[model samples]
Target: MNKDIRITFRVTPEDYERIKTKADQAHMSVSAYVRAAALRHKVVVVEGLKEQTHEFKGIGRSLNQLTILAHEGRVSVVDLDSVFSALEKNYIGLCELAEQERR
Candidate 1:
């Protein structure tokens, strides 16, 4: 087993509240969250829409396969426009979500 060291630090009340809020939003304990932040690690907090998001990912995978098949002439034709548009929209939405989480 690896050994660990404990470190202590002080923060202003406002800073403490801010850290607590972020930790809550990330669904992590304050110490773990703070440690990760101090270590310059990336913290991803995926909120809600779990089932739907999973289904959306499956759809994306299918679209990717379809695109490859269409290019290979395995499929007579596939509407590339609609597929790309849907993917772009999903990408944009995820970006917006990440931006919101950052704030």
Candidate 2:
């Protein structure tokens, strides 16, 4: 910011403390931390989600392989069902998180 555009905002003391800690960890001043947060845009949010999506892709590949192995072999179907249930739960959780992050 070449010229200061002063604004006032409010948050809990605990949140201020947490931001202070994070700024210290990142070697930034609290003002910089707040400024960065205020400037966060949809592109930055999407980029963060892209990284998480990569993890989901890996999980999908592993699940696909497991499904193929179960189908080809005489493996117990109950175990596969359980795996799918867990995947469903995780997928729902991820969806919730992604939805919450949308601008």
Candidate 3:
């Protein structure tokens, strides 16, 4: 089981309005909405970043590797589109997981 802690912070007027608007659009109270957003972002960041850390540090490096490999006749092409699709799927799944974790 996971232990939990509470946090508090102050937001500027513009950010407060933005969060409130987003909450309203989702038909949730401001607190629920903020919690949801925070959970979603945190899960995606944690799950997605693990893989990225070993990918030579960033997308530019990954692209460079792909290009270098292709130029050297080491591989036929880049599979970046598929990689991106998988990453998107991971993000969505993590977001769902976050909501579940919050509940």
Stretches of candidate 1 off by over 4 Å are 1-44, 48-56, 64-74
Inter-residue clash pairs, candidate 2? none
| Clash pairs, model 3 backbone | none
lDDT tens string, model 3, 1-103? 5537767899999999999999999999998898788788744334544554444246557677888989999999555886687567666766775676566
Point out the worst 10-residue segment of candidate 1 by lDDT: 46-55
In angstroms, the error of model 2 at 54 is 34
Q: lDDT per prediction? A: 0.80, 0.75, 0.73
lDDT of 1 by residue, 1-103 (tens): 5538888899999999999999999999999898789889665766744644765787779988988988998998666787677767777777777778778
Per-prediction TM-score: 0.42, 0.38, 0.36
Model 2 over residues 1-103: C-alpha lDDT tens digits? 3856878789899999999999999899999887787788544444355655776787788778877878989554535575577668667767877777763
Ranking of models by TM-score: 1, 2, 3
Give all candidate RMSDs, comma-separated: 13.0, 11.5, 10.1
Cα-based lDDT at residue 55, candidate 2: 62
TM-score winner? 1
Backbone clashes per model, in order? Answer: 0, 0, 0
